[model samples]
Target chain A: MGQVVVVTSGKGGVGKTTTTANVGLALGMFGQRVCLIDTDIGLRNLDLALGLDERVVYDLIDVCSGVCRLQQALLRDKHIETVYLLPAAQTKAKTDITPEQMRTLLEQLKPSFDFILLDSPAGIEQGFQNAIAGADWAIVVTNPEPAAVRDADRVIGLLHGAGLTDVRLILNRLRTQRLDARSTGNGTAGLGEIEEVVDQLAVDLLGVVPEDERVVDSNLQKEPLVLHQQDRAGQAYREIARRMLGESIPLMELTPPKPFWRRLGLRFGHHARVERK
Target chain B: MGHRDPSLTRKWGQGGKRRAMAYLPSHIRVKGSRDGLTFYFDGNVAMEVWLAELQQLLQREHHLFQGPAVPVRICFGRVPLGTEEAAIRACFASHPNLIVHRVEASSTSITSRTGEKERTAPTLLWGPVRSGAEIQSDGALIVAGDVHSGARLVAKGTILVFGILRGMACAGSDGDIEAIIAAWELACPVVEIASRRKSFEKLSAGPTLVRLEGEELVTAPARHLKRGQGGREQPWAKWWS
Candidate 1:
């Protein structure tokens, strides 16, 4: 059976859906049959984020309610042939989907896909429970802020209580430049701040995505960043995908802040000018 | 070939079962009843050696007394159970003691002993504790994670939680009155420490600590307690309730 991975974060807006989109795309690029299920129900965004909003004819609710077949609801990604999107019903509330229903749907989808990625809704409500019902593993998305970490810890505790211990942490939106600058200001608090989280949660550090404009740019373009070959953030997503597939991709070397002119060249998409500069 | 002795005839025909071989030191005394077994060891016997002798004696007559129906009680003058709880429990779960049903302690310091002296370093388990996860630790119980709602944690000593405690936590289960259960969040009201439970309606939020006071498990505020002052001075240090 395929592995069911639920992307969850107790605190909202910590990149749960974004991680689902990118990781799903990255896995698909790695030649895995990936099906991304948006379990947010009423507040669906995975289809939009993956640029498959218009292509969604049937949704998870349709399949769960027996109105449509599983094959009819899966929206195959135009770019990645192996990737499919199962959108949530924007008209139904979180309670519209029960945990048992989700579990049944996941079991049905298990044979057809290599990975089932559930984009869990924010909060620990029915939607979150539904998303995690049949998940073999979970990826808890948390930012660098203490509030985010605390909520992530709560989610970790809940998942652990649920007997889901294969949880990994994906530290998102960590502005290393800011952390470095803060470290330079004070003598010791620089790395200590980041290391404390890893120590407390006691989980594998899956991957870190630098707080870069490319992430937002790719999102605005309605394309997963991992699809962009040149974006550094996209490269981070690709590395996480590779690691998930049991590949040992070396951590990408950070691109040091370029000179003002070089940054301008990079911003303008002129690689030759930046090289010469 | 003369199987004429009443005791020998009784053993040969009655499944070869023998009576529980009792051990009584000359200087001290012991008493047995349907409820429990009590040993009054003189304060003179060193705890370790006396316990070792007691276990060796039990091992010698293994087949006769296999499983006892009543709890075994080891009474002492000022001298406590010779071994630390871990060692004592191992000895008790040995051959003879297994036949005995439950183990009971009625010493004057049974409460204090159960908390500090008897309790060994708890076997800390860190993982998703699912339902039917049976963890019986003689020492203090430290679940470095949350206990699922249906999971049960039965510890002879204290139950310390570095995470949420939604499961049932039975602390002081081995008759330790001083064993306190401290959890980051105590929502489980069905907690029983030494046979005392507070309903879920009575459970409070935030950091909580529950202990047995006067044969009752009372929920109290848990503080970032320092070591060695005992539970008295740190009483009500910080109230999460």
Candidate 2:
């Protein structure tokens, strides 16, 4: 039986759909059969993110409502042979499929796939509940901002309440330069630090994706970042995939390089020289 | 007008006044005593009608009772006043001399005098209250775990959380402004008491207490409340001591 994982974030625009796409793609690249299911229903964007919008003929609602067979609704990715896309229904509401139906659909797909990734809709409503109904693990995506952290905490709590205790946190869109500046007291804005976020959320760290403009470029180009091979965010997603596969990959250093003078002072073992009067 | 008219006095006898009183609404009852005058009203009556009757009575006897502003005790027999309390105070706006010594519900008074505290057992929740989960309590509420964002806890009395609070908490839901909300760590966007709400951008780490102080909602470190400030014993701490 394949493991089902739901990528969810209580707050919107926190990279949930992107994470689902990249992680599933990375798993497929590793010779595992992966199926990416978009449970956003009325607000379907996974197909667009995957550059497979033109190929979608049937969706999750079609499969669940018996309008089409499961294989008929599954859209195979052209770029990645093992990866598949189960697009959500744009015209149907989230209530179109009940939780029981969602569970049955996942069970039917479990035997054929190695990993099932569900891109959950934002919010703890029926859509969210339905997405995680058959999930064996949950990945809560969040930014370092207070609002996103709070929402992530809420999602984590909900995941636990749903009896899916194996939860992990993915800190996305981290601005390394800004975080370094703030820690050095050179920045005025008080964004929550990674440590603070991890403490507040009380979830294991899956990985941190730095603020990379390439993510937007890839989205605009209708390509999954993980397929770019050279993108930093794509590398981070690959590392997360490795970690999920039980490999102990060390987290990449997120702090930006120090100024020349500070680097020289540290090289010469004169730490006090870098301090301002 | 002061000259004695025996025939008119005979026609308007004490029994005649008592007989006429039957036609009046039961809510509007006034009693005179050596101490002062007391006004009692059944809380079920519409506020507009109650206030109108009081205004008319005051205006009709303004001359007779003009010597000094007598203290008046207005009692609402079972009315909670709640958010509508402001309207009651507005009724006495014109009569500045009619000192409102106390405004209380008769039911509360009876319970207090008899030493029988009204018990509203809190609803105890053992797990985290997730987003979109709304829990309402008729009395107090006790949550053994975190209250997540988008989640809501509404209680008629107090709300006590053993874990972090990152959601909305509404205490004193029934208009008891003294009700408080305390949590292990408060990072909520909003905390409300009897319709009064305070939005917080960031909260200090650790346990916190939120209550209505004067007209505003004040948040403070829970430890400070336990130590008692300015040599005044904290009522909340008294339970532990």
Candidate 3:
């Protein structure tokens, strides 16, 4: 009976998929027999994130439809041998699989591995419902924006409605410099604003990921930054994984430079910090 | 966007190759069998070392490494893995290019050892929790009566109280921070989501929705209520003789 954890968000573009890809990869590196199931249906992207898009011969829809066995549908990532991926169908819609069916799929997967992570689709509709059906727990991923937090709040409400309360929050794209009450001109809020949101929402904070362009570049390059080992965002994701594993790893201390840095910023300063062992 | 064969190009050049190559401390155990490579790390080891080892191995065999994303299964034996490990795995999966996944100690241990065992199935809990009843678990906790000040209601999954919750209530203990404590009137029902506390006061007013915002708890208008308006004033305040 392995735990089934769903990584979800109510709004799109807040890094739900990115969080799923990074966290799953980091967990696999930590020696957990891990399987990632993308439940975004037609808008599937987990495979691409892991550089396995070209190799997905069978998909989640295929497994649900009995077109292929769950194991057959799972595409093995070339990098980490133990981790497996079951991608959502590119052609299917949200209603293709019922919650019961998803639950059955997860039940079958539980005994074979230690963890099954579902990459839930955005919004509180059928897709989200199906994604959460079989999950024993959930990881709610949100950005620091007010809109994102509100949406996360809504998602938490829905989870409550569903009688599924084991949901955690991952604050993605946090801009640390904004937290310095001393700073005044940034678009994103600082730690104080984030704390207000967290206090208002009443959920446990799993981790905070900073806004890193390297994540974008790695996505473009078909490599997760977490695999880079030396990337800051990658390290943050790694630290998050360690913290999740009960290792009491301290939060990373890399605060983004204030606007002054923007005026006189060096190109490799951020990169140099990440490279330190 | 063209799909290149990714087969032996300057994936990172020779320097990138060097960085990716090499043994990641050799302390972490990677068992390669006919099925695939299984990584085994002690329950006490830091997750960072295992991740570094995986990356180093992946970089070393950037070309030949083919199976599934590495299934790094931790053999914790009887030791229970907490929510942090699960959170880390979810974060790892969020990465754009990584294929790592997660699992924990056997299912029996997690369910019996930590989550379900915290609070026993209370057949009958009498009276309002005055100070410390510390009720918590994955199952339902039915309080026969109302809860008073300083009392705590913590549950791994759900917490349903038949009476008024005048005291503290924390639903979804463990990592399930999504739990909610609904009552006839949320009058200053000090509520905490996971470890974060929402409003300690009963709004002293009306219905409230307490949930996880980021790292703390928040209480606001339910869906039916309009936004930006200060929540209904504590009706009890005016009535206080």
Candidate 4:
């Protein structure tokens, strides 16, 4: 049976859907049959991220309402044969799917895939509860902000309360948020801030996604970040996916690489100092 | 209810009754009940003068007031005792006798203001006491894990945490001035004890204890609290039983 993972964060705009799309694609690259379920309901965006919005014929609601079978509702991405996108209904509200219904649907789809990633909606509402109903593990995606970390703690607490023991954290937008001196507390966080949050939440760190404009560009271009090879954020997502599969991998170094001239100069200086020694 | 400085209450055995009954204030009426003395204050008198006369009464008739350990319960007749209640507690503090037990208003209950009628046994918990979670106890409360921010813990008696405390902890919620809150790590912004509260701007670096000392909240290192044979939880063992 496949392991179902829910990507969730309690607060809004912490990149739950984006992380879901990218991680799902990365899992697909590893030869796993990946299924993506967008449980955001009215705020559906997973199909657009996969560039398969036009190919969505039926959705989660239609399948739940018995209008179509689960396979008919599932949309396979054009470029990748291993991944499928189960779009959420744009017209329905978050209250549409009950937790029992979501759990039953996931149970039916478990035998067909190696990994199923449920893209949970933001907030600690019914949508989030329904999305995590059948999830064996949870991935909490958060920005390196106090508010986001606080929300992630709340979500972890809820998951623990529900007896879901395996929960991991993803620190996204690390060192990438623009610092604003005018604002009260909305600014770029440092390594110390990330350490404080990780300490406070007390969860296993999955991976860190640095602030990269390419990630935003990927969303705008209607393609998932994992589709773009050799990208920093894509590599982070890949690492997270591998970790989820129980592969041991060290985290990427967060510091940006130096420019070519600066690297060359430092190398030459180090070599001359070694020759003198 | 408490001994002011542990200085007296030994004088209760002497002949303390014959020399009293000189004068009793008009607004204040003292009655003997099955439990100890109950003082009823008329609401018409101003709060200051009422407290002053009560103080003078206890001062002049100090010999008559020294008796059993049952706390003296006061009833405020038909008036809202707001901040005036704290002033009343302050008055009781200097008596070297008499502790403020319960505040009885013509409006509120005589039993439970913040807790049940009687304080129960201490509650022991294994916890993160997660965000948005609330834990309340009639008696003392002990947690083996962290108390996260946005969480709340209120107890009628003392509260003890073996891990970090980053939430709101209110000890002495039922107005017991002797209650305390101690944690392995303290980051609580505000702490309330016996209806009095104090806020902190920074986190405490080590194990700390927050308690009430002479009508004010004071914090000190919890390591100073003696521990016995019970191991790491020894200090709180007495509170549990």
TM-score of chain A of each: 0.88, 0.91, 0.87, 0.90
Can you give the DockQ of every candidate in the order shown? 0.04, 0.23, 0.01, 0.39
Worst lDDT run of 10 residues, candidate 2 chain B, spans B108-117
Q: Write the per-residue lDDT of candidate 4 for residues A1-277, one digit (tens) a residue.
A: 9999999999888888889989999999988999999999998999998999988889999999899999899999776789999999999998877999998999999999999999999889899889889999999999878788878888999999887988999998876433222222222233565567778888898988877789889888888878778788999999988998889998775556657896686666853565566
Q: Candidate 3's C-alpha lDDT? A: 0.66
* Candidate 3 segments whose C-alpha is farther than 4 A from its true place: A180-190, A256-277, B1-241
Best by lDDT: 2
| Model 2, C-alpha of B227: deviation from truth (Å) | 5.7
Clashes by residue pair, model 1:
B47-B82, B66-B99, B67-B99, B67-B100, B68-B99, B68-B100, B68-B101, B71-B102
Between the candidate structures 1 and 3, which one is better when assessed by lDDT? 1
lDDT of 4 by residue, B1-241 (tens): 1422233233566554332222445556665544566676666667777777788777766667776565787777565557888887887786646767876664311221123224477899985887888898988999998998988999988898999998899998989776788999998899899889989998898999887777888888887555311112122322422
**Which lDDT tens digits does candidate 2 get at residues B1-241?**
2332233343434577543443343445665544566666656757777677666556555564466778876667675566545666676666777777877775422211112234655689987787667899987799998887778999987898999898899998899776788999998889999899999888869989888877999888887654432223232321111
User: Each model's interface RMSD (Å)?
Assistant: 7.3, 2.6, 12.0, 1.0
Candidate numbers, best DockQ first, in rank order = 4, 2, 1, 3
Fnat, one value per model? 0.00, 0.40, 0.00, 0.40
Return the TM-score for candidate 4, rounded to 2 decimals: 0.70
Which is better, 1 or 4, measured by lDDT? 4
Predictions in order: lDDT: 0.73, 0.80, 0.66, 0.79
**Cα deviation of B127, candidate 4, in Å:** 4.5
Tell the DockQ for candidate 4: 0.39
